[model samples]
Target: MPTSPAPLAPLDQLPIRGLTSGDLTACADLSEDRGWPREEHKWNLLLTAGMGYGIDDPAGKGLIAACVVTSYGPGLAAIGMVLVAERYARRGVGRRLMRHVLAEAGDTPLTLHATPNGKPLYEQLGFVETGRAEMVSGRFTPTEPAPGIPTRPATAEDLQAILRLDTEIFGLDRTPMITRLPAFADELRVAEEDGEITGFAAAWPNMDTHVIGPLIARDTATAQSLVASLAAATDRPLRTDIDVRHTSLLTWLKANGLDSIAFNAVMVRSLPGLPGDWTRRFAPLTVAAG
Candidate 1:
């Protein structure tokens, strides 16, 4: 008689491992498996700038679950790109992955933009709702008379200023992610006043639309100017995740042309709230890397 097969290890004991550039395709495949867009471009950025974790399928079905943690120094980190295969839903795969991340993160403050379906699980894991972000998308329709704020394409000289402004408002140093914008984005524009950089935004390609993110400005007028300028340069319809607290800016985006797609819960763990000034922070670079 054939001997009984070895006992299957529990999902919790499946051995989670660190992901690298080599796992890009598999990560994209897992995204597709969950019916989410296979954003290989975004995956590349996260995998490079952040640490990725995943659990492999014992049956050879690619990654069972995966997530990325983008740390800004030791003070803050954003968790994103969490995905689990459709076949393994509700089997503790997601919870296992998250616990691993939390363990690895230790006491570092953590943040993430959680979808409606994801909020409950995250809440159970100790993350509290601090705010919300509305995802607006569409072909940007320019209004008569553009914003008065002066805007121009940013140059190499503007890098330091951008990083400085980003750090001040973002409440953490993002040298690693901000530095990649110059090469990664299709258009990097800055709002200027008397030759000093006042605001900046970058429009990067994500599938067919240009995603405007890291929208940093001195005020509402400057934020509108930066967005308008980025829209003017690109023919592709624009998309960006705007903080709901910025009512005027969100309303302007809607009236100008975009429609609300969905809202993401901005949840934080081990912190009272996200660091930095949310007033000047119009939109994040991407919810994934926030």
Candidate 2:
């Protein structure tokens, strides 16, 4: 009798390659297969502004696993959109992909928001939890008296001021990501005081909800003003992942009819903490790209 053919190597040892814009559909399909929203808009931004990596399935079932890393010039990088096909879960594919990204990232500190199910695996890979973000969603209810802080739609001339504030509070020059906001978001607004920009926020379409994020402000009042203004202009329910440390803002958001959704743990590898000023950084552009 002929000897049995050799068993194929585990996917964990398979070649992982760079993903490009062309792989968007497959990536979205993998997301849906794993019960996540397709997130095509978000995926498009990440693919163009960030580096995507994935491994193809031998069985021709699209990607076996995939992840995206948004780098900020060696000082920091963010790892997000990590996914593994459901059929391949618990087989080490996720871990294998993470290890590869970690190697590719070298000494640059990395951060990612992790769901509960993925937290244990990240910890095993040497990531430690530093913070949490509370996600809330619902139609925002206008209060009896609106925020006194003045806010208005952003313009081309406001781009530089917005970028400066974002960099100062975000702790990195995320020009590539910031520049895309005008087109990506349905509404981009800024809070002003004494003719100077004090804060900025964006609300972009995602499925049935309008997600609010990258909410940077000088204080809680300014953040609240930005969120309130953005929420007022949209008909769809609003969603945002607010840093849980902002108790006042989170509580205020809840009071205004945006129901609590979920909490994601902020995890980091090779860094003591995220670089931004959490106090003024009310929310991330999206937890995935943070």
Candidate 3:
């Protein structure tokens, strides 16, 4: 007969501490073991951004059970990469970590991409749904050898151009992600025309999924082409967390036979001001300009 397993106890009593690359690696392994993407860049980015906390066992073995943290902004913050080990589920580790991280957020209302398992807990903490999105997956068809524009691996020289394009598309300066770009991802692609950079994409290798993001293009054609090229370059399916408002992108993804296997909430806590440009084009968000 199989041996009976030890019953899990409340993890609330566990101690938490700041993280380092060594401990961060172990924590990432725990995330991968639970079938989540093991993005070390995500961890380091959060640490560099603001704060990160990891829960430990009573014996001090440093078995990372839970983590909650965010990336910084002058006035805005993105609460991301919240993960907990499966063995410690429903044991209060999440609540404890959340209490600590949220407190660190101060009066700055935070935003995050929330998983289904996390919705209930976050809702109880005042997080609500903004909308639903699909993370599509598909293989890319080679770009048929076009001569309209030139593509090349992005370099430090192109950092200014990349930042400009990203800010134009995202309506925000994503300098933080760019600042640590070298350590965060394996590859970055830039599209150039007339000696000016117009588009870019970043791809990070992960244990569970290949995360690609912030695909900014001067036009839809470039966007589609960049997506195809990035997908072709990866060993795994490309993953992205997109807003529901991206209809054209969604339709193209779905047509390519990519599956929407999960959903997440775009939430904020006590948002004092709203984004005028975004809300004007996309409703259900209002008040003052952030």
Candidate 3 regions off by >4 Å?
A: 1-13, 41-45, 48-50, 142-150, 168-172, 193-196, 272-290
- TM match of model 2 to true structure: 0.96
Q: How does candidate 3 score on lDDT? A: 0.61
Q: Find the 10 residues in a row with the least total lDDT in model 3.
A: 281-290
Error of 1 at 132 (Å): 0.4
Q: Against the unseen true structure, what C-alpha lDDT does each candidate score?
A: 0.93, 0.92, 0.61
Tens-digit lDDT track of model 3 for 1-290: 99887665456656677876667777778778679766675665555654667777654455646554544354456666667777766777777888877887777666666778887888888776665545565543342422345567888899887777555554555576565665676777877888998777667665555566656666555656666676667667666654567677666666664557666666667674322233112111000011
RMSD of each: 1.5, 2.0, 6.3
Runs of candidate 2 with Cα error greater than 4 angstroms are: 1-7
TM-score of each: 0.97, 0.96, 0.78
- CA displacement after TM-score superposition, residue 220 of candidate 3 (Å): 2.8
What does candidate 3 score on TM? 0.78
Candidate number achieving the greatest TM-score relative to the actual structure: 1
The 10 consecutive residues of candidate 2 with the worst lDDT sum are 139-148
Between candidates 1 and 2, the one scoring higher on TM-score is: 1
- Model 2 over residues 81-101: C-alpha lDDT tens digits? 999999999899999999999
Ranking by lDDT: 1, 2, 3
